[model samples]
Target: MTDTFKHRGLRQKLVETVKAKGIQSEPVLKALGKIPRHLFMDSGFLDHAYQDKAFPIAADQTISQPYTVAFQTELLEIKKGDKVLEIGTGSGYQTAVLCELGARVYSIERQQELFKKTSKFLPKLGYRAKKLIFGDGYKGLPEEAPFDSIIVTAGAPFVPKALLKQLKIGGRIVIPVGDDVQTMTLIIRKGQKEFEKHDYGEFRFVPLLEDKN
Candidate 1:
């Protein structure tokens, strides 16, 4: 694909833009540069792709802003080959970033239309995940328990405990918790009975809807 102003801007302005907002991870900046944010948003909003704003995608969900994506990814403290679980695959933009960072992304989406569409879209764009499930992400993926990391794209009333169970020891999970407005949070499973929590601050996100077939 031919590189455009938007694409180049994403790589160029990422550190400056995210640093201004308190995102402090070189790895995240590099990943953001690699992932094409323009492909995730609507054509009308493509010009605004690297401007650090969320843009609407299919299923009435918005692809998160660059800083938010970088902030969440940074909190995970990812390493190469980490087994990652992503709860909501809205637009698969975040998923692409995770995969680009060398995480084995296992993403689940409740929206049938969104999941089905992204299944094709992700591979076509060259950001393939370890797995993609169309069922409710609230329950987490039991069969694939013990993931090295987990990320929830949508906001929930509280951090889902079931997801905690699936997290491997010494792993992290980034989730947005609250109602109306949410706190982007990171949870780390230190051990069998120990864990750590960090709040990345507030964000506006669509509710994590429970979907069943």
Candidate 2:
């Protein structure tokens, strides 16, 4: 939980790198710079933590590149106090970012090991989600229906209906859909049964598992 001047400097550089790559959301950039990405990674790979690339974390998942996190977050168009649902809580980095942006985050992680580790680690880093659940992301948090925004961090073959249904009308969902090279898709709930879809670009991510096996 030690964020030294060096860490802060690296984060500032990381922010500039992400900004140069076209992430214009000031809030998102600020959150990115504020979070200590190295704390979310293994000490052995600490040097690579702020390099704007995804690195392996526990449960065979990657922490996600800073740019991707920023891109998905910006697509959500988060507002202060917005209720956000995060489908994957891998390193809790994105959770920290959303929390930094003043969103109430409800995060789910299917891998018990990563879930347990992150659940304990996040609070130590002073980033707390509104609720951290251990369950299948595909089913989503139906009891906490109608989120202001939902973000799926993994690549799914198709959009989960449960996630779409759990969003508030006019809420937005940012998910990567595809088995191989996933397309970053943004879906806005226009009405009870109407939604608008926008595709950003391609990205490669680990598969989104189901059933909490």
Best by lDDT: 2
Per-residue CA lDDT of model 1 for 32-126, tens digit only, reads: 87777777767888678788888888878888888888888988888999999998898998999899889998999988888898999899888
Per-residue error at 139 for model 1, in Å?
0.6
Per residue, candidate 2 scores C-alpha lDDT tens digits across 1-213 of 689999999999999999999999999999999988999999999899889899999888999999999999999999999999999999999999999999999999999999999999999988889999999999999999889999999999999999999999999999999988999999999999999999999999999989756
Off by over 4 Å in 1: none
Question: What TM-score fits each model?
Answer: 0.93, 0.98
TM-score of 1: 0.93
lDDT of each: 0.86, 0.95
Top candidate by TM-score: 2
RMSD of each: 1.6, 0.7
